[model samples]
Target: MKNVYITRVSKFLPNKPVANDTMEDRLGEINGKTSKGRRIVLRQNKIKTRYYAIDEEGNITHNNAQLTKEAVEGLCDESFSKHDIELLSCGTGSPDQILPSHAAMVHGFLQNGNVEINSPSGACCSGMNALKYAYMAVKSNQVNNAVCTGSERASSWMQSSIFEDEVQHLKTIEENPILAFNKDFLRWMLSDGAGAFLLENEPKGTTPLKIEWMEGYSYAHEIEACMYAGGDKLENGFLKPWSEYNSDQWSKQSLFAIKQDVKLLGKNILSKGVESLKNALEKHNLNAQDIDYYLPHISSYYFKENLYDEMKDNDIEIPWDNWFMNLSEVGNVGAGSIYLMLEELVNSGQLKKGDKILLSVPESARFSYAIALLTVH
Candidate 1:
C-alpha cells in the first residue's frame, strides 16, 4: 500500500481569547443569573480557553469563510504554492454560502485553478472523513497532494431567545421529555473555531510522520439523533413576531439524554472504536502497546468519562493526560476538533516522529468511527 503523510498543519484562532470563567460569566449573564462568587468548572476538571475572531469594534466575529481563509493560508505558508495543490477538501458543518460549497469557496480564495475542491459534511466526524478520503485518494494515485480543512463558527446559533424556544418545543414533546433537562449543559458544550491541514504523498522534510492506514464505517440507524430544523410556530392562534424565514429550530437530541441510553450508546461506540483500532493494528501487525498517542473526538464530559471507564475495563491503557481535550477550550468545532487536536499536539511537542496515533470519532446516529496505526514517522 502507498503511504500518505501530513506535510503541514496550521490553525487560526480569534484574536480575543476567552477563558472558561469568562465564558461561564457570559453564560450566566445571558441566563439572567449572577456569576459573582461562582466557580466555573469544566467536565474534565481542566482549564478551558477559546479564541474568537473579533472585528474592529471588538465584537466576536462569526464569519466562517474569513476564519477558514486565515487557517488555510497559515497551513500552506511559503513551502506550498497554490499551484502545487492538486486537491482540496473542506470538512465542515458551517459554510458562508448556501449555493457554493465551503471547499469551493476555499479554492476560490486560494486562487489555484489547478486544484479540484470537494466538501464533505459529516457533523463532528467531518474532519476525519476528509482525512480518510484524502488518504484513500493519495493511496490510489488519484492525487499526489491534497489538503483537508475543517472550520466552524458556532456563535451565530448561540442565542438565548432561540434556546428558550427550543426548550419550550422539547417540553411539548412526550416521548423525549428528558432532553429538556440539560439545556445549560448543551449550551455550555457548543463553541466556535476553525482549523486546517496540508497532506501530501511525499514527505517534504526528513521527519518521519506517515499516514500508515485509515478505515471508515458509518452507522445510519439513528440519522435524526441530532437534528436542526427551523419553522414558524403558531402561538395564541397567531404566528410569532420573528420573520417567517428566520423562524427556524436548531436542536440536538441524542441517546445520551437518557442515562440508560447514554451508557448503552457509550459502551457500543467505545467498543466499536476499540475494535476498529484492533483491526488496524492487526492488519499492520501491531498492538495496543505499540500506540503512543490516542486522539478521540472531544464529544462531551459524559461521553469522555464513560469512554475512559470502558477502555480501562477492556484492559486498554489510555494516556488520559495526553488525550488532547480541546473541547473545553475551543468548545465543539464539529469536524475541526480532531484536526485541531492534532495541531495542538504537534505544537506542544507532545507528538513526535515515529509515534503511532489512534483516532476515534463518534457521530450523532450511534455511528462510532475509529482509525488506528497512523505513525508519526
Candidate 2:
C-alpha cells in the first residue's frame, strides 16, 4: 500500500489582528472574582493579537460557510483539477447551519464534482479527526486524493450581537463576576481561522511530507464538562438539547464557556497526553531523539511546565528549545490550530531536508488528545 503524504497546506485568517483590549473594550466589563482585566488575560494567556472574521466596525465579514469555502479553495493546486479530489473532510467547532454539514457546504461552494464529504464535529480535536479520515481513505486506496479542512467562525460567537437581547443575563453576569468571567474568558483566548491540507496516495514532489503515523485518545469520562457551547448540562449532568431551552436559558448557556477546574485539567492533560505519545512512539518503534521538531498545539504557555514535567516523567527528553508554537500570535484557534502552527513553522524557513516532526494536539473539551508523526523530504 502507498503511504499517505501531505502534498500541500494552507491557512486563512479572516481579517486584521484584533488585540485583547479591543475585544474587552467593545464587550464591556463583567466584573468577576477570577476575572482580571483584559490586559491581564492577554498577559496570562500569552496572546498578544489574533485574527477574527470581523471587519473594522466589529461586524462579522464572513460566516462559517464562507470561511470554510475559502480554506478549501486556498488548498487548490494548479497541478490538479477540482475533479481529482475524491474526498472532502471538514472539522469545526462552529458551523453556519445545522442542516448541512460544513464539508457539504464547502463542496457546494467549490462546485467540485460530487465527493465523499464528511464533517466531524467536536471541540479542538475535530480537525485531527478529519485528518484521520482523509489519511485512512488514501492509505487504504479508497481515494486517490483528499482535502481535509479545519475551520472556526469564533468571531460570530464572541460578537456583542449575541448579547443584544440579554439584559437580565448581563445583569446576572455582573452580579456573579467570577463565574461570568470563567465562561466568557474563552472569547478572549480564541480567534477565527481556517486551515486545509491536501493529502494524496502519491507524493506531489520530491520534498512532500510523509505521514508516518497517527494516534488519538480520549478521557471524556475522567474530565468534567468544563468547556462547552450551544447547550447546557443540568445538575443531573444531562446536557439539555438546544431546542428544549428558551431564549433566556440560551443566553446563559449558549456560546463558548468554561468551568475549568484548572488543577484537574492541568494535572490530567499532560499525564494523559504523554502516555498517548509514549504509546505512539513505542508502536512505531520511533525514538524521541530522532525527532527534529516538536510541534505542540497548546492553548497557552501556561501549560509549558506541565508538559515538560509529564514528558520527563515518561522518560521522553524532548528539549524545550526544539518545540514550536504560535499561540502568542494566533491564540487558540480551536480546530485550525495545529495546521496554522505547522504552516507558520514551515514559512519560517528553519526546517530543512529530512526533518522529523512530532505534532501534538490536546483538546480541553472532554479531554481528548491527537498526535501525528511526519517527516519532511
Candidate 3:
C-alpha cells in the first residue's frame, strides 16, 4: 500500500487560562461548600487548570471561525500554497453556521476554490474520524495532499434557562444549590481549542511521518443510552429537551447520567474496543506490543482510569507507562482530541519515525479503533 504521511501539524488555543483553583472558587461559591473539600477534589485530579476563549462580556467564548482560520493559516504558513491542497476536512461540534460546513467556510476564507472540503462531526471522536477519512482518501489515490482540522467552542452551548427547567423536574434535588449548578455536571469536563495538520503522499525528498494502515468500526445500541434529541432537558449539553416530558427522571429515565458516558464506563465498551483493534491488527499481522503509543478518546478522568485498567486486563501493554493524558490542559476538545494530541506529541518531540500509534474513539452509539504505523523519513 502507498504510504500516507503527516507533513506538518499545529494547534491554536485561546489567550486566557482557567486555573483549577479559580474553577474551584467558582464552584465553591455556587455549591456553598467549604474551600478545603473543593481543594482536595481538584488536587486529586492533578489538573491545575484548563483554557477556554472568552467574550467581551466575560462569558466563556464560543467557537470562533476566525480563530480556526487563523490557526490553520499559521500552521500551513509558507509550507504549502492554497492551490496545492486537494481536500480540506474540519472535524468539529461547534459550527459557526448550520448551513455551510465549518470546513467549507475555512476553505472560502483561504480563497481556494480548487480544493474540495468536508466537515465531519462525530461528537467526541471527530478528530479520529477525520484522520480515518483522510487516510482512506490517500490510500485510494483520491488526493495527493489533504488538510484535517478539529476545533470546538463549547461554552456557547451553555443555556442556563434550559438547565433551570431540567433541575425543576429532577425527582431528588440535593439541598445544596451548588449541586444544581450546570458546571457540576460531568459534561463541564470539556474545554475549548483548535488543531490543524497538513498531510501528503509520501514525497521523495521531503521528511514526513508515514502512515501504514487505518481502519474503523462502529456499534449501535439503545437510543436512550445516548441520544441527541433536541429538547429542553440538558443531557450532557447536546440533546434537545424531551418533547414528552419537561425533565429527566433519574429513576424512570432509561439511562442514568453518571458524569461520564455510561457505555464508556461499562466493561462492554472496553472489550468491544479491544476486539475491534485486534481484528484490524490481525489483518496486518501485528499485535498490541507492536504499537508505540495508544491514544483513546478523551473521555472523563474516571473513564480514562477505567479504560487503562481494562487495557491491562486484556494484556495490551501500551508503550508509555501512562497514556498520553492531555485533557488536564485542554479539557476534552470533543472530535479534535486525537488530532490535537498528535500535533502536541510531534511538537513536543515525543513522536518519532517508525513509531506505531493506536487510536480508540467511542462516540454516541458507535466505537472505532485505528492503528497507524508512522515512519519518519
Candidate 4:
C-alpha cells in the first residue's frame, strides 16, 4: 500500500470568540430567562472563549458550508489549489441542510472541479471518519490527493429562537416552561468552527505527519444512544428520528435540538474509551510511552481528569506532559476540535522526525471511538 501524509492543516473559527460570561448574551436566553445550568456547565467545561457563526447582534455570518469552505480555502498555496483536489471528504454533526448532503454544499461553495466527494455524518468521530476516508483513498492509490474536514456550526441549532416554539408549546400543554437539562445542557458547551486537512501520497511540509493506522469501534449494540439530535429519545432509549415525527411536532418538541443522556454518558464514556484505547495499542503493538503527543477531542474539561484516571486504571497512561488539548481556549467545536488541536501543534514547531502522535476521539453519540496514530516524517 502507498503511504499517505497530511500536507496541510487549516481551521476557520467564525466571527469573534465569545467569552464565558457573555455566552448567553451571544446565544440569547430562552423565554427571557437565564438558563439555570449555564453557570454550572460553563464552570465544568472550563472554556474561556468560543466562536459562533452568528454576530453579537445575532446576524448570520457563516453557516456550516461557509465555515468548511473557509477552512478548505486555507489549504490553498503556491503548490496546490482547489482544482488539484482529487477527492473531498467532509463530516459534520450539524450540516446546513439534510437534503443535498453537506459535502455537496461545501463543493458548491468551493465551485471547484468535479472531484469525488464524500460526507461521513456523526458526532465528534465524524471528523476522524472523514480523515480515514481521505487517508484510505490516498493509501490505496485510488486518488493522488484528498481534502478532508471535520466541522460544526452548532450555534445555529443552539440559538434560543430555535427552541422558542417548544417553549411556547410546553406552556400551552400546561407543562414546565423550562427546557429539559438534556436539551439545554449542550447549548452551553458547543462552539462553531471548521478544520481541514490536505492529505497526499507524498509529504510536502518540512514536518508532514504521516498517516500510520486508524481504528474505530462502536458499542451501539451494547448500549443505547447517549447523544443525539434531530430526534427524540423514547423511554426505551430508541431515538425516534425527525422523519417519524409530524412536521408540527418538530417545532413543538424541538426534536432538532441537541440532547444528551448525561447519566449514561457520565457512567459509561471514559471506561469504554479507555478499554478501546488499550485494545488499539495492543493491535498496533505500541505502548503508551511511544506516544510523544496525545491529542484527544474532549467536549468538556470536566472529563479530562476523570479520563486520565481511567486510563491509568487500564495501565495505559500517557503522561500529562504528553497530553495536548485546546478545549479550554477554543471550546468544543465538536468534529473540528482534534483537527484544530493538530493544526496548533504543527504550527507550534515542536515536532521532530519520528515523533508519534496519538489521536483519541470518543463519540458518545452511541458510545463509539476512533483512535488514530500518526508519525512525524
Candidate 3 displacement at residue 99 in angstroms: 2.4
By lDDT rank, best first, the candidates go 4, 2, 1, 3
Runs in model 1 deviating more than 4 A are 24-47, 54-62, 164-184, 206-208, 222-272, 275-284, 319-324, 350-352
CA RMSD, predictions in order? 6.5, 2.8, 5.3, 1.0
Estimated TM-score for each candidate: 0.77, 0.90, 0.77, 0.98
**Which model scores highest in lDDT?**
4
Candidate 1, poorest ten consecutive residues by summed lDDT: 252-261
User: Where does candidate 1 clash, by residue pair?
Assistant: 14-52, 208-377, 209-376, 209-377, 230-248, 230-249, 354-377
Which is better, 1 or 4, measured by TM-score?
4
**Stronger candidate by TM-score (2 vs 3):** 2
Tens-place lDDT digits, model 3, residues 69-159: 6667755545566667788888776676667778878787778667777877646656666776777787678988787777876544432
Quote the positional error of residue 15 for candidate 2 in Å.
1.1
For candidate 2, the TM-score is 0.90
For model 2, the run of ten residues with the poorest summed lDDT:
26-35
Estimate, for each residue in 314-370, the C-alpha lDDT of model 4 and write its tens digit: 889999999999998888988899999999999999999999999999998999999
List where candidate 4 sits over 4 angstroms from the true fold: 173-176
lDDT score of residue 300 within candidate 2: 76
lDDT of 3 at 86: 83
lDDT, each prediction: 0.61, 0.77, 0.60, 0.93
